[model samples]
Target: MNTNKSGPQENIDLGNSKVVNIRDKFDNKTKEILAKRVGYLCSNPDCKNTTSGPHTDPKLTINIGVAAHITAASPGGPRYDSSLTPSQRRDSSNGIWLCQNCSKLIDSDTNYYSKDLLQGWKHNAENHAKQLIERELNQGWATTLPEYFESLISLELTTSPPIGRNIGQSSDGQFWLVLWDSRNAKYQWSKITEKYAEQELQSVCKYRNVTNWQDLFEK
Candidate 1:
């Protein structure tokens, strides 16, 4: 005497159903963009797992990644923001790339992984991907120096008694010495040669009494 229809049904109410679960899911384009922006790596800094690889089938590939929502796609979900609209919730800006495990972990423990923290991870992951792409395009010349050198340049420009100076090579294989002088409140770039790069950087560090300058580049 039981009659229940099986197959795709449009919001079938089974007696106790008072509410419908509607999720603002991302479209295929948004998912692909999110994956590419992070280079298909997990956004979790501690767990940057490669999420894509080749499958046994030559034409097929296995993807263990997901475009996870920074804020929940629906109400009562993890990190749900009441302020965001339906369109905003499904936008690429609200997405982050993560592996299956990390996507589940973030949802399971929303307290530890707040909205801001996830946003930071997304920002960093995107930046890392950009740097990688730049390096590849420039034939590795874009990353001749430690990545921290870029941040150091910015820090030295605003601080007193500038101590950050380094020599970097350009994409065209030309070397240049970058110097920051706090007295003038300006930085200067002078052309130099590859052989003098290390020597000049060391000399500048020594004059500035930066004994542990190498630590600046440590991860």
Candidate 2:
């Protein structure tokens, strides 16, 4: 069936599929779970974009995400599976959280984005959500991993004698480790020295009274 663009208006053929009458819609609970499963970010691994944010108007909010179906929501549409029941078609397992751009991109290229691949994306998104929840439950790190890591890298670039580079986590899950080295006026770092760096980082943290070397994973 043709995709619905505007309210109750006539369905327009978007040239991807032939227009039909049936419409498979997801219920509220399913939609909510789909959004939460990905932590409200685009499921596309290359585009983990946050879908919602503060709006220009303080009282409003902006959302650029969509809960797209792995299989077409209606028959005669892209990736429509005739084998699935109507209820199965609308199930949360069939949905993927995605930015508006990625949503359209997947629908536009059904050949490349198969149901199995989309399902894998959904699984990956859920795994990421689990990791996020675990991180949040831990004594609340100051920032997300990527953000914190990028900031550390930035600090490494600007500093002259990048010493004291290390990685360490607090007993309460506060993980922050960074160090840089400027040898012979040339920059050298231990981004690859993760194993050794951890040992050094813990020693540094202990020296600074930051956190001990005990196994404190009881959170």
Name the top lDDT candidate.
1
The TM-score of candidate 1 is 0.66
Q: What overall lDDT goes with each candidate model? A: 0.75, 0.66
Q: Each prediction's TM-score against the native? A: 0.66, 0.57
Task: Tell me the number of clashing residue pairs for each predicted model.
Answer: 0, 5
lDDT of 1 at 185: 40
Compose the digit string of candidate 2's lDDT tens values, residues 1-219.
997557743455555443455667788788778888789999998889999899999999888888888999887677999999988889887788899999999988898998888888888887778767755664332123332232332222234553535353433335455433334222222233445544554553455455643332222
For residues 14-123, could you state the per-residue lDDT of candidate 1 as single tens digits?
Answer: 65442345688999999999999999999999999999999999999999999999999988889989899999999999999999999999998899999999999999
lDDT of 2 at 64: 89
Cα lDDT of candidate 1 equals 0.75
